[model samples]
Target: MTAESDPWAAHARRTVGGPRPLLTEALELLGRPRRRVALDLGCGAGNDTLALLERGWTVTALDGSAGALALVQERAGVHRTRLTPLEAGFHQVPRRRYTLVYASLSLPFTPPARWDRTWRAVRRAVGVRGWFAATLFGPRDGWAGEPDMSFITAQALRERLDGFEPVVLREWEGEIRLAAGGLHPSHTLTVIARRLSR
Candidate 1:
């Protein structure tokens, strides 16, 4: 499909020169020690992947959309050597360890039935003492009940984050303004956590 007809492509194009506040914050929280590798899971438009590359991290960027991966490759250009773009869904995430795993607004897209398995794979990818930064949809999110989406309650979140030392825990429950100029009541939990010892 043409970029005009593909929403993912259109979003990737729009992200080219935009400010990525979440990525900035995530990097700040991750500190400046300069890790060697990172995995940008569900790297929608490659903003996070680009940021990782700019910071001198060899990155593996995975997205379900081919158009999104294309945008990532296009944006990488000279940095292509440090960037690996893979077009695969959540179920196809490769088994590997990484110093950092970034998954912004993407994990919830994993079908509810497959979330546990996916989370297991994600944990394996992070290994011990690795970091994880992501946004998880809360039960009250507008899209929580969607068939293919997964949502967690506050208590459930605590259980899920049990082994990690949460560096940043920000929760919001209110109307979210969409890029399409529409608003929807939503709840989201943004986290930057480090695996302490395990």
Candidate 2:
């Protein structure tokens, strides 16, 4: 199937599972003013991008697919004033200071060799006391064996998240349909962290 047929289009079809129940707690972290800027890394058609915008955060939507960006632009409507859809590779994307950085299920696509650089990029891009939420593929994910994909064991990932205090670290063991429409019930790991003080 062609890129137009990527099954991820379906995943994007689904809404964010639920409003972040921890949002109030997160908001309390802000001393006075609310966060104004946010980044949706690997924003994949801007599903979460839309969610963030709805909450009044100006968003920079980044995705590797032109098609995805197009869809985002269309869905966002007048919110376009607050949205900047970037079509580019993760490596080419510059580090910008943002209050929240969300990667969803997309960072797993970053090649393993580039994982360290990309991880550091994410850490450096967000502002002091910023928030980060993402899903990482565990070593046991079926795709872990894929030569070019990045998958880390929970231990390794925990180590990578060393400095940040995790607000949520959850795991799932089940079949996950791929972006290509194939099914692989595998191990999935998700983490949401926040920079505290530093």
Candidate 3:
């Protein structure tokens, strides 16, 4: 899709700043790793991808929008060699293990019909003792009933992370400004979990 018509492109343009706080926290939890391979799932404008690259992690920036991938490449500069841009939807995510699987605000956009499979793939992608950090929308979010989007409850989220050890699982609700430019009621569940086994 053209950058003008792509919502992700606009989002990338608007969110052009530092890496996400959850990501920073996850990194701190992981300390220094022996292998620095990471997957930036739904990696919009490469905010987290750039952060991973800067820290010497080989990152695969996955996104569905060509415009978003282009922006990632443009911003990668010297880090481009360590960055691999994959153009595909969430359902098509590769089932390969990585030292880190970081999905910022991307999991909420996965369609309900595809969530189970997508999530399973995501879970499998995390290597043993690897980190998985993501933000999922709760049922009270403004976009909760958008048909295609998936929203979860605290209990459900905990159930989903059954095999993983939770490092950070915080839930909060409030009015927040949207990237598209409007105040909206949002309930978010931020999680940083580590795969303990298989």
What TM-score fits each model?
0.90, 0.82, 0.96
Please give the ranking of all candidate structures by lDDT, highest first, separated by commas.
3, 1, 2
Candidate 3 per-residue lDDT, tens place, 113-160, comes to: 999999988998999989999999999999989999999999999999
Best by TM-score: 3
lDDT of 3 at 179: 73
TM-score: model 3 vs. ground truth:
0.96
Give the winner by lDDT: 1 or 2.
1
| Local distance difference test scores for all models | 0.81, 0.73, 0.91
How does residue 167 of candidate 1 score in lDDT? Answer: 84
lDDT of 2 by residue, 35-153 (tens): 67877888776767776778788999888776677778888887889998887666555667888777766788988788788888888776777887777788888777887778877
Q: After superposition, how far is residue 4 of candidate 2 from its true place, in Å?
A: 6.2
For model 3, the stretches where C-alpha displacement exceeds 4 angstroms are none
Compare candidates 1 and 3 on TM-score and give the better one: 3
Q: Which model scores highest in lDDT?
A: 3
